[model samples]
Target: MPLNASLPRRDAPFKLGATALLLVDMQRIWLEPGLDPDHADWGPDHYFYRQTREVAIPNQQALLRAARASGVEVLHTIIQSLTEDGRDRSLDHKLTPIHIPPSLEAGLPPKRLAPVGDEILLPKTSSGVFNSTNLDYLLKNLSIEHLVVAGILTDQCVDMTVRDGADRGYLVTCVADACAAPTPERHSGALKAFGGYCWVAEAAEVVARFEALGRDAAA
Candidate 1:
C-alpha cells in the first residue's frame, strides 16, 4: 500500500462551502514598519519587508476578494498574548523573545486585509495557531475541511500552520506568492520543505481554483 493510500487525493477539488481561507499572522506588526523599531534591520530595504509589501500583500488582496465572492470562510490569526504583560505566551515564544502586547494595534490586520462581515480573527501565542488557539475546534464546528493559507514569514508561522493542518487531516493549500519570510531563500526553502505536506501554488492559481469551484457549485 502506498503511504498516501489512506489519505485524500492531493489533487482533489476544493468544495467552496467546505473550504476556508486562513490568513496567518498578517497583522500590522509583520506587515508594517516602525512597530518594532528595535529590529530596525527589518526595515523597508529588508527582503522580508520588500517581499511582503511588493508581492505578498497584493496577492493576498486578490485571494481575499475571490474567497469572499465564492463564499469561502475567511479567518485571520495574529500573534498575540492574552495578557498585556505577555504572561500567556507559549514557552517557545517566550524563549524566542517574541512578544506582542495585547493592547497594541500590532495585533490587528492591515486595513486591506481586515476581516469583513462575519469573518473571524483568532489570537495565538505560538507559531502554530492550531497549537495555541481554538482554531481546530472552530474549523470542525464550521465544517471546514479544506484550508487555503496565506500569510507572512513563510518560514515560520505559515510553515508551522501548513504542516500542522495537514497532519490533522485538513486538505491544506499554501499560496506561495501570498506569503513572505525573513529572506527570499527562506521563503522558497520553506515551501519546498513542506511541499509534500500540502499543495503549494501561487495566488493566481488559488483564486482561479476558488472561482472554478464557485462556478461548479452554481451549475
Candidate 2:
C-alpha cells in the first residue's frame, strides 16, 4: 500500500520520529477473568468484557507489534489502585472503590506478547494518563508530537487521554476498533465525540499506514 495524504500520515502533521503508540489499559486485569479476586462484582459479565476480549486486545497486540517493528516507540498505561487499601485512588475511584488483587499475573500483557525491554510502562490512578502520570513530561522529553491511541474503554480512559493529548498539541489518531465501552452505543458515542478532535481510524487502516511507511522507507 502506498502512503497517501488522505490517510493520517505521521509526516504531514508531525515527523514519524515524533510519533508514538499509546496503549491504554490493555491489562488482563480488565480484559480477562480470575485476575481480580473481586471478579464476582465486575467480571466477564461486564458489558465491555466481550468487546475488549474479542476486539480490542488482538488489535492492540497487532498495533504494538507494528509500532515496535517500525521503530516507533510503544508506551503502555494501566489504571490501578496505588494502594492495597485504595487510599490513593482518584476521587471518582473513591466514590466507587475497586478491589483488585495485587497480582501482575493478569495486570500486564501475556509474557509471549509482553512489552519489550525498551517499552515504557506508565501507571495511573485516574481516567486520563497524561494528568495522572508523567506522560506529558515524557512525551515532551522524547519530542513526541503525535500519538496513536488505542486501548480498552473507549468512553473513559482512552477518550480522556485523546482529548488531553489533543489539548496539549499532540496529533492523536484514535483506533476505533481497538477500543471498547460498556455498549456499542457508548463506543460509537465516544468516537463521535472525538470526531472533530482527532483522526478516528480503524485498526486495519492504522496497520496499513504503518506498513505503507515501511514500504516507502525501503524504496
Candidate 3:
C-alpha cells in the first residue's frame, strides 16, 4: 500500500476474541512523577507528564475497562532490559540511551494501570515491540488479528508499533487520547504522519466500538 494511501478499515465484524488491546510503555518511568529528578524539566510539570496524567491515563483506563468487559485480550509492554547490565537491548535503544533496569521499580506499571489476572506484561528494550519481543508469535498463537494500541510517547513506540503491526497484516487501531509525547506538536504530528498506517480514533470511540461489539454478541 502507498504510504499516502488512505487507510482501509477492516470490513469483517468486530470479534472480541480476535482483538487485543496492547498498552505500550505505560510503566512508572514514564507515568510516575519525579522519577527522573535529574531532568526536572521532564518531570510532572512537563507537557508529556501533564498530558499523561490528565489525559492519557484516564483515557487508557476507559479503554482497558471496555476491552476487559468485551473480552478483548489485553497486553502491556514496558521499556525494560532483560539483562542486569543492560546488554540485551536493541542497537537502537542502546544508542538512544533508553534503558530501564529490571531491578528498579521504574520497570513496573502504575497500580491502577497494571495488568490483571492472565494479562501479559512484556518487557522490551526496544521502541518497536515487534522488533525485540515474541509479540508477533504470541499474537498469532492467541489468534489475534486486530490490535488496539494505547500508551506513552505517541511519536515513538506507539507509532512504530502501529506501522509494524500494520505491515505484519494485523488491523491496528490507535487510541489517540491514550497516547502522549514530549509536546503537543510532536503528538499531533505523529498521528498525521502515520495516519495512513492505521485507524486512529479517540478512546471514547474505541470504547463505544467495543461496547457495540458486546451488544452485538448479546443479540
Top model number, TM-score:
1
1-219 per-residue lDDT for model 3 (tens digits): 898477546533457678899999998877777675445566558788889999999999998898888888999999999888899988887887777888988779999899999999999988899998999999999999989999978999999999999999998898899999888999999999988888888888889888887777677
**Which runs in model 3 stand beyond 4 Å of their true positions?**
1-13
**RMSD (CA, angstroms), candidate 1:** 1.8
TM-score of each: 0.93, 0.83, 0.91
How high a TM-score does candidate 2 get?
A: 0.83
Tens digits of per-residue lDDT for model 2, 78-145 = 87666677677778767766543345466666553467887898868788998878999999998987
For each candidate, the alpha-carbon lDDT, in order, equals 0.88, 0.78, 0.87
Clashes of each: 0, 0, 0
The true-structure Cα RMSD of candidate 2 reads 5.0
Instruction: For candidate 3, give the lDDT of residue 209.
Output: 83
lDDT of 2 at 135: 96
Give the per-residue lDDT digits (tens) of candidate 1, residues 112-164: 99999889999899889999999999999999889999997788899999999
Give every collision pair in model 3: none
User: In angstroms, how far off is 207's CA in candidate 2?
Assistant: 1.1
lDDT of 1 at 50: 83
